[model samples]
Target: MTSADGKGPVVVKEGSDALLPCSLSTEENIEGKLFHWKKDGQKEVFLYDAGVHYNNGRPGQDEQFKGRVSHFQDGLKHRNASITIRNTKLADRGNYTCDFPRLQNQTFHIELDVGAAAEPSVTILDQIKDWALLQCLVRGASPMPKVEWKDSSGNMVPAHEPQVSQRGDGTYDVTLQAAVNKTDRFRCVVTQEEIYHQIYAETNVLLPPPPEND
Candidate 1:
């Protein structure tokens, strides 16, 4: 990857879209030319032949990117050759090279990093004497997120370590149990360390109803 100008790698969430940066110089007064985007020793990320995008089992194209790649036509006139990758995959992580035929210094090399899921579903499990057991679970994440319990004051709560399990699809499934005092609002936060992404689910301990005045 180029990594030039302190352009760090782009982090994209899985199952979402990603943009690969590239452009040609309009100062060159070029009419139209071929552009190519390919993965390192893997396959062609995208192929533009004389302003036409080729696919449908066309040569020099990879199946992984066949229906997922598209360009911004209006930007093309402004020397923009960037492509968008829809529904990103974990396998999409790596280097991507964008080049224009016969154009000098018109290549953009970028590295893509796929982030994991960070939303956890939380619920009140059981209410015991003075406290309740809260359960939180998040699935379909890579590298397993850190599941934790926090109070409304932003203080970490003492909770059991989450039970982490790997799914058949190569993702992770995690469950954490926490005990919370009634009348307190608690949050279950799941953090993906790779991208420093954090998402949380909130729940509250229900206080007992007041007695009726007779």
Candidate 2:
């Protein structure tokens, strides 16, 4: 079997459905054959044999994946062993293996990466004199995220140390502050390198002109 991307980890956001692709490379039918899906080579994710499948009451499915996984029966004739995991969580990130125990013990490996991500909220907290204090907030993100300020020209803006806090739900809340002396479009970028996810929020700040000399 081969993964859909053929290479690299499959990236997905938390709470979203993730499709782990696995299909026979020879394009042979596998509807009547047996294939097993496992996570980290231990936990049973799903299994299929002939017409009986894990989702249909076949035993041995890991508790974490039970009632949340499904296979494409219509595609079985096409040799597709892909499975969709609904409402994916951060813990779903791991290496997966699809094994065809009936087909000379053929096995294929794939990596799954799930991230809890959200776009930061940017706003002007206060404005005094010619400069304004801008705030960027990212709430309820897992594995945390790197937050930074940037100008319209893509130049990195210097800012104070970000205030980070962990919520009771195991997610993180981040607050970043920057003071701008000129008018421009400022953006708050949030990146989660582990899952290859990135998002940003932008706001326009207009400063009043300086007073004229007497």
Candidate 3:
């Protein structure tokens, strides 16, 4: 119903179906009413009129949404107007609005965050003394995610500033560095706050063997 943050957007896995919830708490019958759904600046994501789904509405529905949008019609009496978008894509990452014009404050909105981030990985960029210099990478996630490091104890580990860049595909690549002591097992975690989507990778960092002396 809600994410851990409560304020974060609803996170959904890439290529997976996503639901944008909207319900009128009061008695609202939308049988023939113009119940509309849309993303900002985009064509109608879905429309209900004359007891028919207008996902194929004229004026050209966005091709990306064809045949993948649906609503809960059975709950019309209960005012359940939730919609599901199947096989969601990165482009679906944004705010959505669903509303009933006949009622005041009937506009319900939600955000969809999609995560297709490749497997997270850690590389030993360098090492010094008891600290093993580590580099963590989170590749290709939409809405851009924040990366953090944690120790085996689940405590937040100290990490240097992270370097994040956007790829041509509109996803993001994030790299961060941490110094893990020999006794530490560190994990690199990436999270998309809007949807609260997260993925993590772990690595055991051991102190490098002492330099050989001739």
Q: Name the TM-score of candidate 3.
A: 0.68
The local distance difference test score of model 1 is: 0.78
Q: Is candidate 1 or candidate 2 better by TM-score?
A: 2
Q: Give per-residue CA lDDT, model 2, range 64-153, as digits (tens).
A: 998999999989989999999999998898899989987888888888878788668888999987999999999988768999999999
Candidate 1 residue runs with Cα over 4 Å from true position: 1-6, 24-31, 55-60, 104-107, 123-133, 142-146, 152-155, 160-175, 181-185, 191-198, 202-214
lDDT of 2 at 170: 70
Worst 10 residues of 3 by lDDT: 1-10
The 10-residue segment with the lowest total lDDT in model 2: 1-10
TM-score, each model? Answer: 0.69, 0.74, 0.68
lDDT of 1 by residue, 101-154 (tens): 576646667888776676689999899767789999898787578888999998
As for lDDT, the candidate ahead, 1 or 2, is 2
- For all predictions, the C-alpha RMSD in Å is 4.9, 4.1, 5.2
TM-score of 2: 0.74
TM-score for candidate 1, residues paired by index: 0.69
Model 2 bad stretches (over 4 Å): 1-5, 122-128, 139-175, 182-209
Number of the top TM-score candidate: 2
